[model samples]
Target: MWGSAGIVKPGLERINRLLSFLGHPQRNYLSIQITGTNGKGSTAVLLHNLLNAGGFRPGLFTSPHLVSPEERIRVSGRVYPGQLEKEVRDLGKRFLRRHPSFRKDPPTFFELVTGLALKHFSEEGVEVAVLETGLGGRLDAVTASEPRIVVLTTVSLDHQEFLGANLEEILLEKVAPDRGGCLVAGEVPQYLIRLILMRKRKVGGDLFTTGRDLFVWRNGKGSFDFSVRGEIIEGVSPVKGTGFQAGNALLALAAFSCVAGSVSGKRGERLLKVLEETVIPGRFEVVPGHTTVVLDVGHNLEAVKAFCREAGKLECRGRRVLVFSLMKNRDPLSLLRTWGEVADDIIYVELGEMFHPFRRIREVSSLLGVKVLVAKSLRDALSRGKKIAGSGGCVMVVGSHYLVGEYYRLEGKTADI
Candidate 1:
């Protein structure tokens, strides 16, 4: 069903056909659909945690698992049991046997996984499920669930080739799943906000936005306070990424308020307590040791800019070294320049066969027009970064999630960091 590893086919026909044949398990429970350029995964995860804390069984479906494929479909932040996998696989076989035509044209990887998650959520009796789109919103497989509430995180230029060239076009593609429940958005340009408002009006949906409907501010210690319609929840999030994460947390809170009622007083405090302890892997994850190492999956320009901003806020005693790699299609020069602005030294490495056909390290170094270190492997890159960082220095691994996963696998470390 997959033509290439990263190629995206945006439509609903394939997934709809498959789900229809599978008894429409997505219809059994309520859903919240999240889609945007970035922070969708974090928002889904945070929302899952909050809902689970509030005594609800919420299933979460996200993409690009850090370690295991089972990470894509989680119940209460844990992978589903082996029986679910067996059930899904057996169901798929039965479906193909009943409809021989499907054997020739099977569902795509993401579509199959999404179907499995929906079935698992239904069988497990989850009250609600959080679905993060694999690609743009309009035709993503998650849209097949027809979510009641939709949250649009920070929208920026990332998948331009598939989505659009400009913000307006991209917004149009991402906002197509809006079916008029509650549309919660992060801080975006006024024009994009107007477009969202227009969509809300068309769908007859309520709109809540950061700095307007909902407000979040970070304190000196990096903990955040969330305010919505005069009700303030103090010390909401302790997740230390960029300031953008505060906005993501607010989006999650706003979404929770939409489905589960307003968050205030004791309930708000409980949610904050859960948020205070939540740590999303590969999003500014800091590993403590003799030399500090940071792992982040900030691939796009906006995400990388946020990473740079957060890196500048670190209280490092020595130089800030960056270890980076990117897929072949990504714009490396722009990301490299953004990292160069905050990093004292940069090391480029080959991600090997897993992320093969990657951009050559020498070509990237040549484009930067600077003396950048090139490593043969991720382990070598980490070693070189630590040496360059010296004592009390900081080393940052960024650009792509694949790079971070490779590092974890090579170092025999868990992706749960």
Candidate 2:
């Protein structure tokens, strides 16, 4: 049983090394590499849904599954645990034997998991797979897959230590090496476009604005009336979360257009209806408990911004209680400051299961300008958060998907949190 700590690292070197020894299984199925600071999960979901609707067997690979690792690899919205495990075992056995050099490093957790996904997707004969990057762009395990289509959902300043100091540098590392046509949410940094042209000798991957291309203006009944467009065609997202979900939906629309030829406006409409009905648990998910609780995996500035913006719009008249934790690399102070203005009281807790340390939990939340409570653990935080919500107000738990996954683990689920 190789566990998480032994498996994680800086880049694709381990996977690349492992795959080269095993004969590169990632190339077997067409995969679109989805890279960005935010929206990777939702974009991957949209990509998976669109391809499945187009009569294609598509696999979706994402991280920190809201409920289970089974959520990480899906074909046509169905998770195949038995099939996934078989592929993982086969690949794990072979890769370990074949890559003696990488064995010293042990192919960090994400790299091993990615290898498992590639093997599963390949063995399943999936027509396509959406590979959402774990962190940063360059040297990530997904880069070893060398996708045919590179999709940038959006880039913002996050992951400062490994991804570089500024947006331009981050964009260069993320988008420059992209070999194929890109599909981006409109208006990436000017420098990123320049680098893409420099590398591929081409231009144009930008779609329309998030609000324009995939809009959720409002329905009279308090639900959202939304539409997502790509290449002059529009699809509706039935499952609504926040306005930023539009960006992810539109990213999917562009991906579908780029690969499958535009969806027949009629098929697309039906697809849109199907999409609107999608339920990705824990992502802006409003769970009906004793009090209303919204769970999100917003680990960075841009993601936190989107979640807080949407959280502010909720019609609940009660106090807004926030239970939060973040990774060491995230902008915790800045994120908490932003959440501070919107949330009524903040409950800070540690995510013990991640690569980060526990003290960072208190350090970051201390920067907030409001009343902050420190919980010994996630369960304690949830108990306190619920008490603060007190049968009336809204309780929001957010931070990293690691935090969300940790929550799922405490809830007694069968899969990886």
Candidate 3:
């Protein structure tokens, strides 16, 4: 939501009302609610994959689909059938029609989608649902379910306009899920970590941190090991990016371990199998071709830094080229400076004018004091980036999810992996 212009009414009353009218489908299944500025989607997907591999019928609810709205909801890594989705939408409309109050004060788009996902999960008889918060944790529609386990991935300074301007305020708003039971967090700053501990203590929740309670370290190529409460899991991570992904994997494993009890050697082996097979789209995904193409949805500064760090690790034969854009509110110059440190050339492309009000290419180029190639469209940008990279080099598409989504739309790619 930070990358787009949307009125974020941060309150749970609307979603609560909608869920109550829909028969509280969320209560019918166990759930894990994940929240953070970044890494929540990847963490949620990883947890979903773990549950599915562990013989549990898991439903996943994520956000900002790369191609279609249906990508937001899935059962066992598969989108719900079109007929099922249509039925749920019709049911939601019928409920709204019957309840004039909802019609008068309409639920937000996210609220409606949350309800639909919960309903579908319930109807599909899922054993557990992994819900990634659409925005800040406290008032996010997903919070209405009161999940059994809560996972907080790295809390950075994004969505400040809606959450807060500073780290303390943002951390406070995002720690709403630290109510009770097990609360797992990534290796965030010490100050934020203290805030999380304080909040968890206030709510009588047990906290498991990446470096403190859970330990994870890279073992070898594409492999990492994690230890929690005297139990250790050595596995190969499918996510190919900065070390941040290993932390994300540990967070997911710790959360699932807490929910499913200790991770035995056999279970750890199963988790590793799932981790090696799972691939999340738009998170440093490598598309095979003559020139390596990496795609990621990293709009914020922290995310951009991670993307660049990971891209630098790739074995590029030629120059590294970048195709990028960001929303109007973000500091495009800072992003450019970070990317410039790793990229040999940059091609700035304008995204959609409505939701994605991307920064002007000329403005960003001037601020950075660097000559950047301006493309008339995403297609042109890709062509130019590939041409610059040549057959031996690599081209990375980064900055906003909108940019990555546009690329997928142009390429007619609907698969998430």
Candidate 4:
């Protein structure tokens, strides 16, 4: 049947086709939909982990899987048992055959994966499924799920072509319909604020934010400390390398407050336990070394700016070198300009063989007035970047999560020194 072989297409017909084959499983349960320019995956992970810990039996879904396609779905902290993959594949085949017209346009990889997650969730009778949008939120396959709670993490100036150049236009297209409908901690563009005010007059729903509901902060200790809905916990948040994770924790807490009243406390405790156990592979993930290595999956200008500012606050004094790579769709020059200030040198490398590399990493570096070196492979780039940092200088591996994931896989294979 029509699976992930064709060039990517939009519209819900193929998704509907796939779901029908799976017996319309997504409609079986409520879902928490997460959409944003960045941090959507991390936020979804946090919510899924905590909700599962609490006893909600949530099915978690996120995009651009670091390890495998199955990583996209988590049931009580992992993709369901191996036997289910065969079932999903078989079902997808049945789906494409059923819809001859829709089958002409195959479901993209993400759409198929999303379909499988929903199908699995429905089969397991999950309490809720945390669904993260793949890219632009409007027509994304997950939006068809009709989320009960829509969490819009910070909106920023990325995906300009697809999302629009300004916040007002983008928010209208990406995040307004669900206005007052459990809006989480977003960057809150001025126009969005205006649109929200307009929405409130009609009494559609109640919009929420960090200041309006909960608060996040950092204690002197290495762990994150934060206050949520008047409850304070030190080190309750444990996302690595991100100073703003406490903010995300607050966002999750607010989301729970808005909708999780039905969940039992014992189940809530379990969710907290799972959250403590949850680990997103690349967002601000740190690697141990004499000169510490930090990896962040911040590809956009705003996210990179945030990552750099937070990394600077760590006061990493050693020769700080950066391993930079990005996709063709991203703003490479803007990202370079933002990251250039934080590093003594940058080694540019491709995240994968499919990426159309920029021969201009050096030129962007020159434009930004930062030292740059282009390397042929991630191993070579990382090794050279480490050497450049010397004994005390810190090395930052960043730009794309793909680069970080490749390095992580390599790190697992090397014998400990």
Give lDDT tens digits, candidate 3, residues 85-163. 4554665677677776766566666777788899889999999999999899988889997798888887888888889
TM-score of 4: 0.87
**Where does the lowest 10-residue lDDT sum fall in candidate 2?**
230-239
lDDT of 2 by residue, 289-333 (tens): 667888888877777888888888876667789988766556667
Q: With candidate 2 superimposed using the best TM-score fit, by how many Å does residue 44's alpha carbon deviate from the native?
A: 0.1
Any runs in candidate 4 off by more than 4 Å, and if so which?
1-8, 83-92, 176-181, 200-203, 218-237, 240-242, 262-278, 315-317, 351-358, 413-417
Candidate 2, position 92, lDDT: 64
Q: Evaluate all candidate structures by whole-model CA lDDT and list the values in order.
A: 0.81, 0.70, 0.81, 0.69
lDDT of 1 at 18: 80
Which model is ahead, 2 or 4, in terms of TM-score? 4
Q: Backbone collision count in every prediction? A: 0, 8, 0, 11
User: What's the CA error at residue 208 for candidate 2, in Å?
Assistant: 8.7
Candidate 1 lDDT by residue in tens digits, 22-85: 7999899999999899899989988999899888899999888776667788887778666544
The regions of model 1 sitting more than 4 angstroms off are 1-7, 83-93, 219-222, 240-244, 353-360
Q: State TM-scores per candidate.
A: 0.93, 0.84, 0.93, 0.87
Candidate 2: deviation at residue 55, Å?
A: 1.2
Residue 134 lDDT in candidate 3: 88
Residue 303 in candidate 1, Cα distance off native in Å: 0.3
Scored against the true structure, residue 149 in model 1 reaches a CA lDDT of 85
